[model samples]
Target: MDKKKPKKVFVEGAIPPEKIAQSVANHQSKTNIGAHSIFLGQVRADEIDGKTVYAIEYTAYKDMAEQVFHEIRESAFLKFDITCAHIYHSLGKVNKGELCLFVFTSSARRKIAIKATNYFVEEIKAKVPIFGKEIFEDETHQWKVNK
Candidate 1:
């Protein structure tokens, strides 16, 4: 199952816009990749119990989470004819509208790339033991579950 030495997929904070752009730029050299798909997950300001969410504090059991990510990575490549894939998720508090997750997939065809990216995202959401605490505007908080 050692396809690629389980890439480091976690970023220290909210993923910066520049980093996303750089990811695209870095792939320009891959001439064989005809298409690339990207998925970005952002914190949303949702009103819950008369309070507005301001940010999300993300946490995870690092070793287990990474192992889950690794399994997902291998599964994705096995299921799709993807040329490359990348996943990044925030490790700390990320404000509303800021990026918390980034998933990229590339292939010779657009459909495969898009499909692989979506599959990776679903696997991550359903399998990863990552947790998020939604912080409301008034400092109240609640555990977040992906919906």
Candidate 2:
């Protein structure tokens, strides 16, 4: 088990581009990390039943979601020889083309970093309780179904 405390993963709104840059910058001092992989999940303006999605309103049971996220991270650490990992997911409203999720992983090798990042993304999409309501251009909305 990871002895580190769980990280706060939920952001109140769409993640800013600067935040992504800052995250990368923060890792510059970690010289042992030979490679880094990142995954960004953006809100897509999808046309559903003639209505176009313009944004997504996300909500979650915060406490439970955080616990699950911590568990996933712990499992990832045990499964991969990653030097570092981070995950940020948005809550509340996020406009189309905005970022909703950010996953970062670092390792001594390129393949390990890339595989760790992919594992985080897939596990998050399948296990997290966070829900997204896709808002249409016409002001209608539908609950998004994760694939």
Candidate 3:
């Protein structure tokens, strides 16, 4: 069964802090969910060749990314006893210290929620065709890869 529909997961630029708070508020009424786990991916100021990264320009094949995201969510639902899940990823320039991706999962127990959140993060990193161009302090850039 398709327990959930394919939803828009991409956000422009940086993922705002308030978005996280709002998500919590939105689910407060879902009393069945006893535990919630959230994973926030922040752009790091990675130093390389005497330069520090100031921002990251992200891009993706949107249609394919969405399909992959949907498939991941469906698999997670089957693998975990989760009540709900949500994901948001940045599609443009995100500064160091700003959030780039957000993955939230809710379940009746701590273990399921925690594991599902980790699964979602890992799947996104491995399966999503997201590209990040690290822009350094000196305006120089380099391609980024998840390590």
Q: What local lDDT does model 1 show for residue 25? A: 100
Candidate 3, lDDT over the whole model: 0.95
Clashing pairs in 2: none
Q: Is candidate 1 or candidate 2 better by lDDT?
A: 2
What's the candidate order when arranged by decreasing lDDT?
3, 2, 1
TM-score of each model, in listed order: 0.96, 0.97, 0.97
Q: Which of the predicted structures, 1 or 3, would earn the higher TM-score when compared with the native?
A: 3
* CA-only RMSD, every prediction: 1.0, 0.8, 1.0
The global Cα lDDT (0 to 1) of model 1 is 0.93
Please tell me which model should have the higher lDDT, number 1 or number 3.
3
Question: In candidate 2, what are the lDDT values of residues 1-147, reduced to their tens digit?
Answer: 638777899999999999999999999999999999999999999999989999999999999999999999999999999999989999999999999999999999999999999999999999989999999998999999998
lDDT of each: 0.93, 0.95, 0.95
lDDT of 3 by residue, 1-147 (tens): 645668999999999999999999999999999999999999989898889999999999999999999999999999999999999999999999999999999999999999999999999999999999999999989899788
